[model samples]
Every structure is written in structure tokens, then in C-alpha cells.
Target: MTTGAPTPAYRTSTSQQPRRSRLRTLLPLGLAAWLVLEIWLLTVVAGAAGGFTVFLLLLAGFLLGAMVIKRAGRRAFKNLNEALQRGTAPGQGGGNGLMMLGGLLLMIPGLASDALGLLLLLPPVQKAVGAYAERRLRQATPGTLGDAFQQARIHRPDGKVVPGEVIRDEQ
Candidate 1:
């Protein structure tokens, strides 16, 4: 019969769970509100007299913004994938959540929100965000997260005498 507890899968601890949940709930609501506004704008502009031309212009702008955002998203995802393959965690800082919020903002009826969202979706921007997040993590706990990259080991120079970070001799 053993008395010790099992080890955890991941080393780092996340922030409050309920706060994250509340944000998740609000995200969808914001998205929905923006969508409603977009629909209303489209209807109003198209329905008004002498507004057909304006409607078409707005439509064109929307399509262009969508295309730009799509391209940016693709690039961001590719970079994130590459980072993961290199054994480094990518999109470190609130990445998915940030992207989601950005996308939601982009989905709003205004050109400003669309531009902001597309900026957030860009590969360079995403990378910057990830790097900032990594830096913060390192600042918070030096060598702890990186230590997880490989098995804990301690090595000494000028010779070969030191206790490793991990011991697997239990085998």
C-alpha cells in the first residue's frame, strides 16, 4: 500500500477558473451583439433610398477585411504550429483567448474593429504577444517552466560528478 500522492501532468498553475469562465460567457455575447449590429447596418443602408451605392461599398470593404483577416489567421496558425514542433509552447500569453476576442471585435459593424481584429490576427503581432507572454513566464519563475522541457538534471563542469535533476534508477 502506497501513501504518497501522484504527480501532476503539468507544472504551472493557471489563474482563477471562475474569472476565465465569466470571460468566456461575455465573449459570445459581445460577438452576438456585433453580429446584430452588422445585420442592422446592412439592412438600413440597403433599404434607404440613394444608399445602394453606399451599401455596395460597405460590402466590398467588409469582404476585403474578411480576406485580410483570414490570411493573417492562417499565417498566425502556421507560426504557432512551427513553434510547437520546435518543442516550445507558442501563443503563450492568453493566446487563443486573445485571438477569440480580437475576432469578436473584428466581427463588429465598424471598420475600426475590423482593422483591430485583423491586426491582432497577424503573424507578427501574434508572435509578439507570444514572446511577451514567454518573457512574463520567465520573469515569474526562472528556469522552472524551461526546466519542464527536459527531465530535471544537474550537471557539474570540470568533471562528471553531480546529481541529476531526475533519477530513473527505480527501474
Candidate 2:
């Protein structure tokens, strides 16, 4: 026979609502704000310069973004192929990923995004951003993702690793 307490007729304080994740709570709000800002900025531009000018700007940004994306993709694939041919691990990431990101940002409608995308395309900006990311990865706490990276770095032929997993067949 079960020996547990009977259920209470009234609700108890122990039963609480599940906490929402920070991303879940804020992402929609952030997207909404960004959309509003983009729309407002586009209207302002349209008022200052005719709608045709705005249309031209959007078309230009889209075309440039597509070109940049194509170039970056080709470069990245070439690098990978060369590394494979050499029978060695791939080289560390350079600006290709960031360039792709910039291209994607440029493709998004809005002058602000276009400006930010252009900035990302700059060599100096890419270097600074790369350095910052490197610093962050190095600074990550032990036993976390940082540890995995450290292990992977040690094993890679060029002492570099991208997204990967290690499996040891323990005997």
C-alpha cells in the first residue's frame, strides 16, 4: 500500500510557474524594436529622398551582399579543399565567416544594417573583432567550452580546431 500524503484541495506555494529563458523573454522584444527602428528610418529616408532612391539603395545593398557572400563562400571552400589535399587539418578561421555575416547583415533591409555590414567588411574591424573573440575564447573558464577548445587545439595538426567532437574508445 502507498504511504503518501493526500492531495490538498487548495493550491500550494511549492507549485510555481516555470522560469522563462532570458533569450526567450528578450529576443522577440528586441526583434520588434529593431523592426520599428528600421521602418521609421526607412520612412525618414523616403521622405528626404524619394521612394525610388530608397528602392535603388536596397537593390544595391542586396546585390553587393550576394557578391560578397559568393566570394567568401568560394574562398572558404578553397581553403578547406587545399587543407584536405595537403592531408592536414584546416587552417584557423580568418575573415570569411565574418564576411559572410556582414553579407547577411547587408542583405537585411535598412540603412543602419547596411552601415554596420560595411563596417564589418573592413579589415581593421575584422582583425579587432577576431582578436576580441580569441581573447574571449581564451578567457573562458576551465571545464567549459574553453576546455574542449584547449584539448582540440592541442590535437590539431596546426594547433587549431573548429567545431568538432573527440571520441576516445576506452578499452
Candidate 3:
């Protein structure tokens, strides 16, 4: 007496719906709490040091961060060029980029971000981060496109390699 079509596999009850994680519910609360704490800390510091002094300190931090960004960006580009010339991966010069990011973080008006930025700008921290990133990248992808280009021949039973260049047709 049943139709030819099979029944759907989905659950019929509303209670069967997946429950969301507590972390998701708590994230906004945590962020709001942190923001309140930061505001309170800033207010206390300003009260102790005077508003004018706090303004000057914030201005100095912003200016210092901008200068660091400019200097680090230049140095990173220089290092990238040198690495390329020496037949090394451009990623080896990622420290400069990290420094620039640190500088950017410092430019943001927050004590925690400024502290993190300063840490990232440190030579030892930059080195450690760079090494960790390099290790992860290597583990994720054993060989890159550059390695494929360096290989003389590739053996594939399923498909033949087609060697050709595409000419863009600009309309």
C-alpha cells in the first residue's frame, strides 16, 4: 500500500536538533567583560596620571607604532629581495611582515594589543614565530610548485603532461 519513493532519513522531532556549544554562548559575554575591564583600567590610569598625560602617552604610542610599521615594512621588502636573489624562499623574510603586524597592533588604542605587539616585534619572539610557521607550512605541504618545476620529468600513467602557454585575448 506504500508509495514507491523511500521515506526521508531526517529526524522528525524538534528535540533531536543539535545543541550549540556553551563556548559560543559565552563568547560575547566574555568579550563584553573584557571590554568593561579595559575601560575601567583606562579610567583608573587616567585618573591617577591626569587626562593630558594619558592623551600624550596614547599619541606617543600611535606615532611610535606608525614609525615602526614604516621601518619594518621597508626592511621586510629588502629582506625579501635579498632572499629571492639568493635563491631562497621569500617566506624566510616573514619577520618583517610580523613586525609590521605588531606595529599595526600597537597602533590600535588598547593596552593588551600593545603588549602583544611589543612582544611580536622582539627579535626572539619573531624568530620563534617564524620557525613555527615554517615548520607548519612544511608539514602541511611537503613540496611546492617550485619543486615541481625543478623536477626534470614526472611519470603519470593516467594522464600526460601538456606543455603550453596561454595567450590572453584582450577584448
The candidate that wins on lDDT is 2
Residue pairs whose backbone atoms clash in candidate 2: none
**In candidate 2, what are the lDDT values of residues 1-171, reduced to their tens digit?**
778998889775645867789999999999899889889889999999989999999999999999999999999999999999999988777899999989988999998889889999999999999899878876875466667766767676875645555689999
Residue-level lDDT of model 1, residues 1-171, one tens digit each, is 777998889676466333558879899999899767766665665677446665555566566656655655776788788998998877533455456656665555564566677787777897787788778977987676556544333434555556545547875
User: Stretches of candidate 2 above 4 Å error?
Assistant: 1-18, 140-171
Each candidate: what lDDT?
A: 0.65, 0.89, 0.80
Off by over 4 Å in 1: 1-20, 49-51, 66-171
Against the hidden reference, what TM-scores do the models get? 0.35, 0.72, 0.60
lDDT of 3 by residue, 30-124 (tens): 98987787677668878999878777766776887999999988888788888889998776555777888888988877666677788998999
* lDDT winner, 2 or 3: 2
Give candidate 3's error at residue 135 in angstroms: 3.5
Q: Report the poorest 10 consecutive residues by lDDT, candidate 2.
A: 156-165
How much is 132 displaced in model 1, in angstroms?
A: 9.4
> How does model 3 fare in lDDT?
0.80
